[model samples]
Target: MAELLAPASCPLCLGGDNRFYHQDKVRCYWHCAHCALVFADPGSHLAADAELAIYRQHENNPQDSRYRAFLNKLAAPLSQRLGTTGLTGLDFGCGPGPTLSLMLQEAGQQMAVFDPYFANEPEVLQQQYDFICCTEAIEHFYQPAKEWALWLTLLKAGGWLGLMTKLAPTQDEFARWHYKNDPTHVCFFSRETFLFLAERDGFTVEFIGNDVILLHKKALS
Candidate 1:
């Protein structure tokens, strides 16, 4: 008989230990004690082609009023912090239609967008920005640590990194949580996970809403 393997390490914080959190017919989830992030085992994540197919089916119309309102939740607050015209920002992982970038542009922020499947603009990632918005994208990260480090590098000093994703629920609630059902969503973050990241990286973190978070990079002295 083969011996059982150990639980996977936490991807976000590189914590070597984790506990089984939840499992459905399709995927198993784990909880990181060190960072409080609940995540799906990467083996269960969808292939790139399958993931792109699902993303292509999204009705991310920029003109959709309801969708615009949903994006405004992050844009409004981020713009308030930006405070002045001509600030440059990047909408990291802006999906097919990219309504959030449009909303920020109308508010006098100059914006660029990068989506691996849709926009696929490599040059955008090459430049630093005053702020970066990543709405509904962090959960899909297969390697949260690398992706986050790149985002932090692409941000100028005193820059803002805004994120919007549904936070994970209590451990007891995980078995039935709908967010875990998405095969593309490999990593999940809670408020505690964000706080852990902020403390680890020296960024000032703020929870703007139930689904929104902002991490501010301190300016160089």
Candidate 2:
């Protein structure tokens, strides 16, 4: 029985560093003390096809005014940071319809898009960009370390990375949170968690509004 019940490793924790966080009707969660990342049990994750089915239902097209406004939360800040037009960008996870890329393009940024399910352009992943925006997508990461490494590799020196995901609420509210109810949402980040990324990985972080986070990479001298 002891052998059967091995230590459970948190997906975001490299050394399996974690503590039991919370549980709901659907799944269990783990909290990493080092980064303050709340992650779901891997056993509860949706398979690729199942996850794709859920994504397929999102109406994230260019025609949706509401979606454009939501994206503007991150885009507006990022546009201001860029300060100039014609900079290159990558919509790290543009979802099914790819509207944010279109929005930034309209703002005068050259944009490339990559979505594991919808726009799987291998070429884009091989290149670095002036900025990268990943909205409402990091929560679905099962192997967040690898993804983080990839993002760093794909960003130019002094580049900006913008993210828009609902931050994890307090432990008291964890069970009642609607964001965690989604089967695809496996990883959650707090301000502390993001700060850990910035301090450890060489970047500066700023929170915008309730959900948007901006990280600026160190520039080459």
Candidate 3:
């Protein structure tokens, strides 16, 4: 069982270090002491085919008021920061429907959508954007450090990276947390984890909401 619980490293910080955090009959969790990220063992991740199947079942309709409202938690705050004008952004990991992209477009922002499974557009990844919105996606990252580096590279200097993911709970709250139950959610982050990344990556982190954060890329000197 030791071998089963041993994840090679913390996917978020690339530290070959972590302490056992939690476990159930199905999956085990780890806590990265360096970055304060709680992640599930890699062996617990779902197969690519199965993951895509689950994504395909999502009803992320842009017309759904409830869904739009959920996305507004990130969109509204990001829009306020960007203002109403010629804003260009990327909707990273936009799932199958790309509702967030539509919402931003309606608010007069030119948005590009990309998802490894849905909108696999490599060219979009190659372009630099004024801002990037990654709603409901960060938790699904398998190699979070690599993905985060890519986001920093894709943004123009002084650009914004808006993300939406539920923060990890305290040790006492972990057992009852429902977010970890999702097989697709591998890496879980807390405010401390975000602050660590911000300090390391030269970003200015702001918690716009309980589940929303905005990381501003520092302008070059």
Best by lDDT: 3
| Stretches of model 3 off by over 4 angstroms after superposition | 1-5
Look at candidate 1 and tell me the lDDT of residue 89: 93
User: What's the distance in Å from true for residue 24, model 1?
Assistant: 1.2
- The residue-by-residue lDDT of candidate 1 on 1-221, one tens digit each, is 23324356778888888887777778777888999988887778788999999998889998899999998888888888877889899998898898899998888889999988899989888989999999999999888888888987899999999999998888888777888787888888999999998898879998876899988988999
lDDT of 3 by residue, 1-221 (tens): 56554566789888877989999888998999899999988888899999999889998998899999999999999999887667889999999889999998999999999999999989998889999999889999988998898998899988889999998889889889999888898989999999999999899999966799999989889
Candidate 2 regions exceeding 4 Å error are 1-8
TM-score of the candidate numbered 2?
0.95
After TM-score superposition, the amount by which residue 168's alpha carbon in candidate 2 deviates from its true location, in angstroms, is 0.5
Which 10-residue window of candidate 1 scores lowest in summed lDDT? 1-10
lDDT of each: 0.87, 0.88, 0.90
Instruction: Judging by TM-score against the true structure, name the best candidate.
Output: 3
* Model 2, global lDDT: 0.88
Over 4 Å off in model 1, which ranges? 1-8
Clash statistics: count for each candidate = 0, 0, 0
